[model samples]
Target chain A: MLNRYYRVQAGPEGYLPPAAASMGVMLPEKGEALVEGIIVSEEEAMQKIAEKIVNAKNPVFFPGPNILWAWNDSVLEKAYAVNDLVQSSGARVIPMPDYRPKYPMINPEVEINPNHPNLTIWHNHIDVCVFVGVHCHYANIALKIIRGGTDCYTIAICGEAGHEDAMISLRDVSIDTLRRLNDVIKSTGEGLK
Target chain B: MNKGLVKISPCFEDVMPQEYKELVEKGSYGQDYGVADLGSFKELIEEHPLCAGCGLALSMRLILASLPNPESTIIVGSTGCSALAFSQVALHNIHSLFGNQNAVATGLKRALKLRFPDEIKDVVVIAGDGATADIGLDMVMQSWFRRENITTIMLDNEAYANTGGQESGMTAEKAVLNMAPKGKNFPKVNLADVAQVAGCAYVATCNPAKSRVLEKAVKRAILAAREIGPTYVQIYAPCPTNYKLKPDEVLATVKNREKEGTYPTGEFISAKAQELFESLEGGSK
Candidate 1:
């Protein structure tokens, strides 16, 4: 509920707080931002993220159970797509090693750990952490603590907004939204740099 | 550290894999090792190096015999005496970490279900009391809470029999064991009661020495997991070496515990499971 930039409010869905509305995506057809909360479209969310992806110095991706929930049928394919885009952008990916070592890298990875302290160790180094479809309970409140203590920016793509941790929350997104985000980054990423 | 290893193998260099291969090639020595033909058509387990009158070993044999479909069942074992004989059993088995049997089984069951979808593959967790009720209790309880379609069998041998008879959480109150010089101070964990409250569709406590009760409990646990949610079967197994009793007195120890009202043997089926089972049974008939 407590965030640096975004304000929380109830929506028809869980909670829809606009992600990167300040990034200036002109949407005359979708209407202006509401008094309740700004409703950012998937295309706008992807475009904003694309700019960040090309300009990122040290970005990290922490994918969670939502990835499994969204891409229940083809989890491996979606994970590989996300991994390829993140890795190509020179981002570090970490997963809960102890519980499911093969989960983070639905394909394969070199390192894994359940404890989130490994993320805290690189406090000053990491500029942004992209949490795609992460649940609230999985990380032991480490996400909230990490955002509260450190200056690292976070972008959460999950079922709802008001995730306290993420600076820009693309709330109430489907599996296609995530895939398109990766695609946008893959295509327009070269132009930004 | 190497003293015990040396004693088990006096001339370890000569104990080669070729010797076991030749013994298998002979093929006529099936009945030579005193394999019991206890009215059963087939034997799922083979002779192992467990001590005489070992109640845990007997419990494992009874459990293996009670599986509804041995070919489709996968046993996930933890570190303990039972793990030593797991390799000897003629079935699919996995020995993960000491207290991670339930966690490993959860992932395996979910993954298997996703892959197969049509076939019913039974995934069972078979481990000692120390692995289940003590160290791995959180994982076991969490799996049950999540309603994982799996069966868990805890061979309750009172103490940590595998690790030099140390005191475990399942150790009975006022009983003086290895680590508890004065007394255990706490009562034994009634895991059957815990399982019943934790949403387990089937829960039972049985003495392995009573072969019929243990077998029935194991079968029900497996069958109930398919229809209902998770199931748990706790077998009261006694250790002779740790209890400082004669090899023939292990069953007597379990009997005394049951008689003293410490470890009662009976099955506890949930209401939903009972209804579903009876309907399925009636329809089949």
Candidate 2:
């Protein structure tokens, strides 16, 4: 018998629980380690993220569609937290251009092709790129390209599991997580000044 | 396509898009990528415009990740919500007419076979239920009957979600929508059974609620279509907008439906395809 998170009950016709249907198949495990390629506590990861943003000459926050969509009640709070972080850290917030037309228009100041992060980094001379509320798969694609072809450091503040490819990954991030990080960045930046 | 074609020119290295450069350096061209390898490597799909928590979008992401040969594969899409995301796919994809996906795949597969006879160029047709079960049922069935070496996958949202919520052939009986004001008159189309009868070498009915199951079905369908004949995989990708369900509620709804026996996941493989899978599994073991 397989252990399932959801309770299984017998139904009428051909319905079988996912565990039974997927017998002998190995499902991908959800990873909880906040940072990848290194072991660190959640507080340590947050400190590292704040330090990178505060120390960088030019840092930009790339907010993906999840920040705009009202998919859940926490999303609006997440967006507000991101705004607070940008304000405190003096980071430029760029909404990642999406195919959807109704949402935010492309920013004329920075032409950041979501497919090509290096171009944006090169054109704007961005030193650090912080990704928040971006879908996991898309973020993975961008992070790999940025790491492989650009000098800009990458940070991912994910709603779920941490990204293994990101330089500093804050996993299961909530509004509190963002607020705490923002406080750290403000203090760090003030100390530097 | 030659892998070197995407390589950045020495002179244009400073100007070429970083994505193309990364594709040459770390893309999943000849390598094997399963669901477990998702966030570790560069995915073929970029940011999509789909709704938040859209099951169709998640299904597309998982399907792309599960492709056995992403480099050599060409996707044939149709007019629907899925078409919007096709533009962002890193692999070569064609958005055909609303109901002409299989027709397009047939020609594309034949032409690619002629162009590269020795190479394996897998042509796949991915469309919505409205396009597959109703609009292009004839063309889709004919392709399977002819045993065209292509895979046909239906992103079954159960209604015409791209347009305002309209009743589609795949919509379940008694489901109220724009066209079906009172309720849908007929039960959902039995597309899986029809595919089996229409000479499909392998057939499956799955949903995104079971990502691993969906992944295995997609991988098997593509692999079977490579040598065996036509293949079909119907994925129940729920439409949160049209269904009036919250984004996060879609997966739970699918799970509830599965438990209630309204929608179940199963597979049907021909003897030849079964033999192929057994041999492949044995080798891997």
**lDDT values of the candidates?**
0.65, 0.78
Candidate 2 per-residue C-alpha lDDT over B1-285 given as tens digits, one digit per residue, 9 for 90 to 100:
545344432322333345545766777767788877878888887678888888899999999989988878999999999998888787778889989999999999999989999988989999999889999998999999999999999999999987888999999999988766899988899999999999999999998889889989999999999989999999988999888899989999889988899988899999999998988877331
In TM-score terms, which candidate is top? 2
Clash-forming residue pairs, model 1: A97-A113
Which portions of model 2 miss their true places by more than 4 Å? A1-193, B2-5, B283-285
TM-score result, candidate 2: 0.61
Q: Candidate 2 - CAPRI tier?
A: incorrect
How many Å off is the CA of A71 in candidate 2?
A: 42
Q: Interface-residue RMSD per candidate? A: 21.3, 17.3
A1-193 in candidate 1: lDDT tens per residue?
2234454222111222233233332222221111212445556656766666567787777655434222334555555565656656667764322222221222223222223433432543666666654554444254444444455556665544334334455655555666667678877766755
Write the residue-wise lDDT of candidate 2 on A1-193 in tens digits.
Answer: 5443322121211222233213222211233333434546777877777888888899998777677433445666677788788889888865553322211333334435456655567678788889887888778766666766666888888888767657677777878878888888888888887
